[model samples]
Target: MTAAERRASGSLAIIFAARMLGLFLVLPVFALEAARYPGGNDAALVGMAMGIYGLTQGILQIPYGLASDRYGRKRVIALGLLVFAAGSFVAAAAPSVWWLVAGRSLQGAGAVSAAVTALLADQTRDVVRTKAMALVGASIGLMFAVSLVAAPMLVEVIGLHGLFTITGLLALGCIAVVFWWTPPAPVQHANVPRGRLADVLAHGPLLRLDVGVFVLHAVQLAMWMAVPALLVQAGLDKDRHWQVYLPTVVASFVAMGAVFALERRGYLRAVFLAAIGIVLLAQLGFLLAARAPSLPVLTALLFFFFCGFNVLEATQPSLVSRLAPPAARGAALGVYNTLQSLGFFAGGAVGGWLAKNVGSAGLFGAAALMMLVWLLAAWHMRAPQTPKTAEEVLADEAEAG
Candidate 1:
């Protein structure tokens, strides 16, 4: 990659990581901590507080990316970051669970993920785009691992309010990085076609990928609705939950490496289907183990869950970037992310409801059904083409120019 490509990819990856860290950091502690707030003890309201970000994020993701395509990437991103920072501050000072929910909704309203991703695509050549996206993906995975381990420790020192304060500060820092270090957006030709939401919605393969992401994240949020409480019930202290998470996350990374190797060897479709199958099985495992609730069994189940989750998380966006029409990449990704956020909202709301009414076992069972549907959809989906060589990408660019 060129120096410009490296700078753009590396800087944007960190920015994305920073944003995700803020979100994931709260997940581990929110259920227990929020109970201290007014109206926090209501399971439904707590779930809404946790997942409300997804509602606004889902509503705005496509509009933000579409705006970026027309207006400029950095402008949209910077504005979004400012909004995010404001939301963080709001949450930090919130006196009630309802206020926290409103704050979380505002955080989602920023909706810059599609814009940042579109900017990465804008800055890199086709040949290097996948690798750049992979770097971003790996950073996200790393942040998630770090958040699981660090959140408990950090909460011990700063409390949840302090964590929100830190996240707000990080957003301000990301805004500075955008202005100072990020690359300029590429200029578009007057005659080049811009992507339409309607077109993206109509595309079959893209729709499939969107559904896959939706199911993946929904199941994830649903599982979290129960997993932390399960750990505590199994005799692990909330502070020491990291012992299980840290090891499982590390093992999942190793598993991801193996999956990536298989994809490189032309087993993309096979591996994709297998990964979805594993996710389904893991959910089933949770359902069964929910009855007995043993630490060893839950820990084993978590390892399998993360193994599938990590691979899917890394694979989905790269696939979207590759399969999207060159002109409509931003819109395509926007739709993709919109569905993902919707999944988050659905997972938390529905999962929390299920946990409260039907129990955690029912929640896992529902998640398993969702994955079973995804597995079938994935089975019919086509594998992405082999990535172009740098020389080939350059030749194509030369011809287009």
Candidate 2:
């Protein structure tokens, strides 16, 4: 990467990290905390409070990205961050479960993920764009891991209200970074035509990626709905749950490194398939562990589950960007991200229902079933064509004309 590319990637990472930290910081702590409020004792209601952000984000992400095209990236992003901060304050002060849901939904309305991604695409030339995105992806993954560890401690120290205040401050911090860290936005690409809904929907490869993202996040949220409780039931203290998490996260890194090595050796498709297979195996492991009710057994199984989840979480967006056209990249990502958000909403609701009605075993069984479906869908998916560098593709197009 050139100096400019490095700067662009770093600036984007800072912005992405700040915005995402606010959202993810609450994930590990919310369900248990919200249960203390009125109506929060109901599992489904708590799930709603926890997952409502996905619903609103799913609805507005595309519109937000498209609006950025006309109104400019920084302006759209700044507005979204302001709204997100407002929602954070609402959530911090919410007294009832319904009010928490409302606040979460308001937070989702900020929905600038697609817009931010589009701006990143605009800033970097194609050859280095994937590397740039990898930085962003890694930032998000790191934030999720950090949240898993930090949220509980932070909650204990300052309470959930303080967490929300911190999130609001973080949003304002992103606004400052936008101006101080990033170069001025580029002139819009003349050849990159406006995104069309019909065309974006018709793109089969991108649709497959969309499904992959939806299933991925759905499974993620659903697992958390029950996994933490399962850990506590297994005699692991809530605070010490990190013991299981830390090791599993470390193992996932090792596993992902091996897969990347395979990809570099020209076996990308095999590695992708293998990752899905591992996820299926992990789901089955979760189901079996739930049935046995052994603490040691469940802990072992969770380590397996995270290895698969972490790998998939890191890889899916690269697939989406590879499949989508340059002109429609924003729209394609918008649709893909929306599906992911919906998964969170649906997963929380369904996971809670299954756990409440049928118990933890049933919840794991349902997640396993979803993974099974995703595996089937993936089996039929054609591997994406490797994308040409920006310079190469542009040269070819000019010569053809």
Candidate 3:
């Protein structure tokens, strides 16, 4: 990789990490801590408060990414960060669950993942793009671990409000990094054909992966609605839940080494489907945990969940990037993130509604059902062929001629 590529990847990784740390911090505690507010007693409302961010994010990701093409990546990103920071502060000051929902909605409105990813893709070559994306992924994985440790402890210090304050500050810091540190993007992104969104939307493999991401994230947020309480029932205090999370998350990362090993052995499709199956298994485990709520049982289930979650998180975006045309990469990813965000929204809102009416049994059962559908669809997915740049395609055409 070139020096500029290194700088871009590193800078973007840090930016993503900082923003995600804020989100991850809330996840470990929000289901439990949200009850402290006035409207928080309503499980459905609490779910809304937790998941509204995804709704706003899903609504605007495509528009935001397209805007960056006409506008500028850094400028749009900075503006987005400011909006996120505002949302964070708003959440920090939220008086009730309703206000918290509004704040989370505003936070989602700052959908910058598409722009950030497009910016990184612009600066890096296809050959190394996976590694760059993986850097971003690893940073996020690290943040998830850090938040698991920090949130339970910190929530005790300043509560969710303080975490939101820190979240806002992190966004402010990211804005500075974007403007000053990120490498200048290549002009090729603009020179290339501004491909139609239909081309991306109509893509078959891309659509399959999109559905998979949606289900994956939906189940992710949905499960949290009950997991924290189950942990409490298993005799761990809310604050000490990290004892389970840190080890499970860490161990899960190690287990994912086998996933990569399987991929290297030419079983990409098999491994991909298996990962979904693993997630499904974990969900069923959660369903049983809803009955018994044993600490050791819950701990093992979490390990399986993290293992599946991490593998999916790393694979899907990279696959989308590989499958889409370079010129239309932004649009493809926008569509991907949109579904992902909506899954988050559905998970939170629907999960909350389900939990309120049917309890954790119904919630996990629904999640497992979604995964089953995704696994079936994913079964037909073809392994992605490594894509060439515009230059490579043109050169090949000329050579053939």
Candidate 4:
């Protein structure tokens, strides 16, 4: 890679890292904190607060990306960050679950993920685009790890309200980075046909990928809804949750190496199915833990869960990139991302509702069901041919998955 590409990737990675940190900081602690506020006792309302961001994000991603293509990437990104910061402030000050829901909804309204992907596409060449997207993915993975470590400490010091305040300020700071640090704008081509919205919606492979992403994120959020509480019930303190998390994270990272190895050795399909099977087992473990409530068992179970999750996380986008055709890659990715956002929201809401009404066991049962459904859906999916170009591969894989 050239110096310029390296610089661009580094800056964007940091920017994404900060943004995700702000976005995810609340997830680990929100349920317990929100319970202190009015209407927090209602599981459905709390779910709404947690998941509203996904709803708006999914709804607006296409429009935001299209607008960026027409107007310009930087300006749209700046505007989105500003909106996100504003929503953060609102969430920080929210007095009721309804207000929190409103804030989360506002936060999702930013919907700049698609625009950011498009910007990277415009900024980088096709050969290196997959690497750039992987940088973005790595940023997210790092932020998730950091947030899990930092959240309990932050909540201990600043509380959830203060955390929201800090997030808002941090988001505002990202605006400056956008203006000063990112690369110069891409020169627009008049003759290159842009991906069509209708075409993106109509593609069968993209739709399958979209459903897969939705299930992936939905299961993720739903599991967390019960997992933390389960940990506490098992006698682990909030601060000490890292004892379980850190090792699992490391092990998962190590496990993901095998996934890459499989891909390099042309066993992508087998690896993918194995990862999903592990996830299925994790869900089953959760169901058992909910029934029995044992710390050692839960801890052991989570190790396997993270292993599966990390593998899937590392490989899914690569597959998506492999699947997508060149002409429609961006649009396909946009749709895939939107579904992911929707899953985040739906998972939280559904999990919270089930936890409240049917007990924690039911929450895991539902998550397990979702995984089973995804596994079934994937059973018929052929391993898509690797496209010659990364962009074509991404588009095709995304469609195929």
* Model 2 clashing residue pairs (backbone): none
Once fitted onto the true fold, the runs of candidate 3 whose alpha carbons sit more than 4 angstroms away are 189-191, 258-265, 387-401
Q: What C-alpha lDDT does candidate 2 achieve relative to the native structure?
A: 0.77
Residues 1-401, model 2: lDDT tens digits: 77877887788788888778887788777888888888988998888887888899899888876677666788988898888889988988988989889888988888888778777777776545556776786677677677778888999998777788888889888888877887777877666676665677998777877887788788788888888887887788787776777666666656566755554455657766677777777777877777655677876676666677666665576666666676666777678778888888888878778778998778877777877887888786666555566677899999999
| Candidate 3 per-residue lDDT over residues 1-401, each given as its tens digit | 78999999999999999999999999988977889998888999999999999999999888877776666678778888999999999999999888899889999998998889888878887666766776787788889989999998899999999999999999999999998999876665455666358888889899988889999999999999999889998899887888998899888877776755555455767767888999999999999889989999999999999888888887787788778877777788788888999999999999999999999999999999999999888888887654565778999999999
Q: Which stretches of candidate 1 lie over 4 Å from their true place?
A: 391-401
TM-score-wise, the better of 1 and 3 is: 1
- Model 2 Cα RMSD, 1 decimal: 3.5
- Model 2 spans > 4 angstroms off: 125-128, 190-192, 387-401
lDDT of 4 by residue, 326-380 (tens): 4555566678778888998899788788888998888888888888898888766
TM-score-wise, the better of 3 and 4 is 3
Q: How do all models score by TM-score?
A: 0.94, 0.91, 0.93, 0.89
lDDT of each: 0.87, 0.77, 0.87, 0.77
Model 2 clashing-pair count: 0
